[model samples]
Target: MTQLIDPFARAISYLRVSVTDRCDFRCTYCMSENMTFLPKADLLSLEELDRLCTTFIRMGVQKLRITGGEPLVRKGILTFFEAMSRHLGTGALKELTLTTNGSQLTKFAEPLAALGIKRINVSLDTLDPAKFAQITRWGRLPQVLDGIAAAKAAGLRVKINAVALKGFNEDELFSLTDWCAANDHDLTFIEVMPMGDDMGSATRLDQYWPLKDLRARLAERFALTDLTEQTGGPARYVRLAETGQKIGFITPLTHNFCESCNRVRLTCTGELYMCLGQEDMADLRAPLRANPEDAGLEQAIRAAIARKPKGHDFDYSRQKVAGKIGGQMTRHMSHTGG
Candidate 1:
C-alpha cells in the first residue's frame, strides 16, 4: 500500500482542494472589499479535480476536504458531491468534509448529508447580527444562522472556526463556547496569521491573540480538558471542563505544530502547495494539461511532496512590520485552502 510521507516521517493522509478563488462575503480578515477574484478560466474543471482526488486516494489519502472562497457557490459543485458520495459508499475514501462560510449551506445541507458527508467546518466569527455584518462587510447573520440549523437538521457534525483577533471579537470567546456547547458543536479558535500578498495591513498582525493568553483568560470562567479523539485535522482539541464542549486552537504563529503536519493544499488554480505557511508549490495545471494521465499526475504529486519544506517558517513574535510579504505566510487563506 502506498502512503504520503514527507522526509520528516509524517504520514500525510489528508488533502484540501480549493475549487474556486471567489467568495460572496468580504471577510475583514480573509480579504479586502476591493478584492479582485481569479478569472473563471483559471479554475480547474470538475473533471480535473475528480481526477486529482482519484490519484491521491490511490496514493492512500484517507481524508478529503472541499474548500473554496465559498465552495457551494462554485458551479457544478453538486455534481462533484454526487461523485464523492459514490466513493464514500464504496469506502474508496475514508472520510469527506468541507470548510465553508455557510452562505449557501441551508440549500445544500440535505443533499450533502444524503451524500454521506458527515462533517463540515463553518467559518463564523461573531454571533451578533450587527457584528457579523460588520466583520463580513455585508454578511447577513440570519442567513448563516438558518444554514447552520439546516446542517444540524440534516445530521451533519458541525465545527466552527473563529479567528481570535484581539480587538475584533476576542471578548466573545466564552460566548462562542457557550453557543457551541448548546448546539453540541465543536469550536476552534484560530490565531490570525499573516497570509496573502496584502502585506499592507499593519494592524492586522496586532490582532494576533495567542492561545495561551486566550486560554488563561477564558479559563477564568471555563475549565478545559485535553481531548485526543481524531477528527482528521491539525487542531488540538480540548473540551470545556464543565460542558464537555470541544474547543480547538490553531496557533501557527505563537506555537506552530508543524512536525505532525500531514496534509497538502491544492489551490483552485491547480497548484499543489506543500505547506500552508510556506510558498513551496508545484504547478499541477501545466503538467495536467500536458499529460492528463494518472501516472503523470501521480508522479507530479510525489515529486512535490519530495521537496515539501520540513516545516513552515513564520515569525510573529517580532514587531509587526507593514507591507512585509515574506516567509510561508505569503498566500491568502482563501486561495491556500484554509
Candidate 2:
C-alpha cells in the first residue's frame, strides 16, 4: 500500500472530487446570477472519474467526498455513487460521502443511504424561506426542507453547513441552531472565503463575517465546551451544553487550519487543486486519457502531491473597505466544487 505524503509531511488521505461545475442555485456568494459553466465535453466521464478515484484508493486514500455546484443535479449521478459503494464494502475506503444543498435529497436520499453513505453535509444558510431564496437566488425553501426530512427518514446523519454572512444570516444564527437541535442534526458555521470572481470582490468583502464574532455571539446563548475532535476536515468542534449538539467552526480567516491539512480537491474537468486558496493545479486528464494503464496518471498525482503548499493565503484584514479585494482567488467557489 502506497501513501501520499506532501513535502510538509501531511499524509494526503482525503479527496474531494467535483462531479460537475453546474449548479441549480446561483448563490449570491458562490457565483454570479448569470454564470458561464464548463462544457460537458470538458468534464471527465463517469467511468474516468471512477478509475481516477479507484487509483487514489489503491494508493491509500481513505475518505472520498463527492461535491459539485450541487452534486445531485448531475444526471445519472446515482450510478457513480453505486459504483463507489464497492470500495466501502471492501473496507479499502473508510468513508464515502457528499456535500449537497439538500434540494434533491428527497429523490436520492434512500438510494444514497442504501449505497453506504452513512452521513452527508447539506449546505443550508437560512431557515427563513424568503432569506433562503435571497441567499441561494434560485432555491425553494419548502423543497429543501422536505428533502432534509427525506434524508433523515432514510437514516442518513445530516450535518448542516451555514456560511456566516455579515448582515445576511446573522439574525438567523439562533434560529438555525435551534432548528438543527430540534431536528437532531449537527450544524457547522463557515466563514466566507475570498474565492472566485463570479461574486464580485466587493460582495466577498461585504459577505465576510468572521467566525470569531459569530462564536462570541453563540457563546452568549449557549455554553460551548471546546472539543479536540478531528473529523478529517478543517473544522474545530465545540459542544453546546443546552442542546448537547456539536457545532463546528471552519474559520479559514480568523483561525488557520492549514498545518494539519490532509486533503486535496479534484475538479470535474480532472484538474487537481492541492490547496483551495492557491491557484496552482495539476492537469490529470491528459494522462488519464492518454494512457489506459494509469502509470502516467499515478506519476502525475505523486508529483502534484510533492508540490502541495503548507498553507493557503486567505486573508480579509488587508482591506477595511469594500472596494478592494484582498487575498482572493480568481476562480469561483462552484468552479472548485465548494
Candidate 3:
C-alpha cells in the first residue's frame, strides 16, 4: 500500500525523542530555579518508546536522536538503547544520536556505544571548570569531560555543543576553537534559542554570541574555510589554519535556515512537535493505541505532519525576552528533548 506524506513532501524521516522532563543540573538558560518536573508515570515507558520508534520507522522515519534535560539521567537508558537497537538495526537508523549535558556520560558512554549508538553531542558551555559549575549549577565539569573521553574511547563520533550566550561564554570562543582543534572534536557554537523564553529561561540579545564577530576574531588566529552543503545538519562548517580541525556554527538568530529544516521533535509526553518554535503539537499515544489498524494510525500521523508550519518567527528586536510568556517553567528541555 502507498503511504501518505506530509505537506512538505518530507516523510518525517527524523525523530528527536525526549525521554524525561527532569534534570539534575539547573542551567540558567534551560531550567528555572524552582522547576516542577512531571511525574515519572507521565514519561513514555521503555515499551512505549520501543513501540513508537517501530511505528515511526514504518512511517519512513529513519534517523532518531534521543534528547532530554539529559537523556543519560533517565533510568534504564542503556537497556532502552539495547532494546531499540535490537528492534531497529543500526543501518535502519541512518543515525541514532543523543543530545546530553554529559554529566552522566562517563557511566553510559561505553554501554551506549556498544548498543550501536554512533554519534554523540554533549552540551558544554565553558572549558573553565569553575565557570562550568556556574553555567550548570550542580554539574561537575570533570565528569562531563570524562564522558567525552569515554565516547571517544568507545570509537563513536563525538561532538561538543556549546551554547554561546553573549556575556556568559562568548569570551571563551577562542578557547573553545583551540580546544576543539587540539582534542580533535567537532565543536558547534549554538545561538541561544527563543524557545528558552517560552520556558521562562530567556536571555537578552546582548547575551547572544554573534557569529560575525566570532568568525572575524578566529580569522586572525586561523585561516577559516567553508564546507560543502552536503556536510549535513545546519551548522556551517569551517577548518582551522594549518590543522584539519573542524568547527561549526548554528546561527539560527542571525541566519535562520528554517526553509531547509528537516527536524521533528517528540515531546516527553508523547506529543509530536513539527516545528521547534511553533506551539502546534499532536498527541499520538492515544490514537495509535486506540486504533491499531495501520491505515488508521497512518492517517493520524499524516494529520500531524500536515499541521507542520513552514518556519518559526522569533522577534529578535524585542527588549523583554520573556515578555508575556513567563510560565514556560512548566516543561523542561528534558521533557521535549531539546
Ranking by TM-score: 2, 1, 3
Computed on alpha carbons, the lDDT of every model, listed in order, comes to 0.83, 0.92, 0.75
TM-score of each: 0.96, 0.97, 0.91
lDDT (C-alpha) at residue 45 in model 3: 85
Off by over 4 Å in 1: 323-328
Model 1: per-residue Cα lDDT over 1-338, one tens digit each: 57878888888788999988888888877777888888888888998888888778888787899998899999889999887767777787888889999989889999999888998999999998988998899789999989999999999999999988888788788788889999998899888777765533567766778888998887888877888776666688887779978789888877768877889999988999998877779988887888756777778888998888877877665434654445536557788768
> What's the lDDT of the predicted structure labeled candidate 1?
0.83
Q: Give a tens-digit lDDT track for model 3, residues 17-61.
A: 888777888887787667788888777787777777777777777
**Candidate 2 wrong stretches, greater than 4 Å:** 198-200, 319-324
RMSD to true structure for each model, in Å: 1.6, 1.4, 2.7
Q: What's the true lDDT of residue 22 in model 3? A: 77
* lDDT of residue 124 for candidate 2: 93
Could you give candidate 2's per-residue lDDT for residues 1-338 as a string of tens digits? 57999999999999999999988898887888899988899999999999999999998899999999899988899999988999999999999999999989999999999999999999999988999999999999999999999999999999999999998889999999999999999999998887766434555577788888999999999999999989999999999999999999999988989999999999999999999989999999999999899889999999999999999988877653446565778798998886
State candidate 3's TM-score. 0.91
Q: What's the true lDDT of residue 196 in model 1?
A: 61
Error of 1 at 313 (Å): 1.5
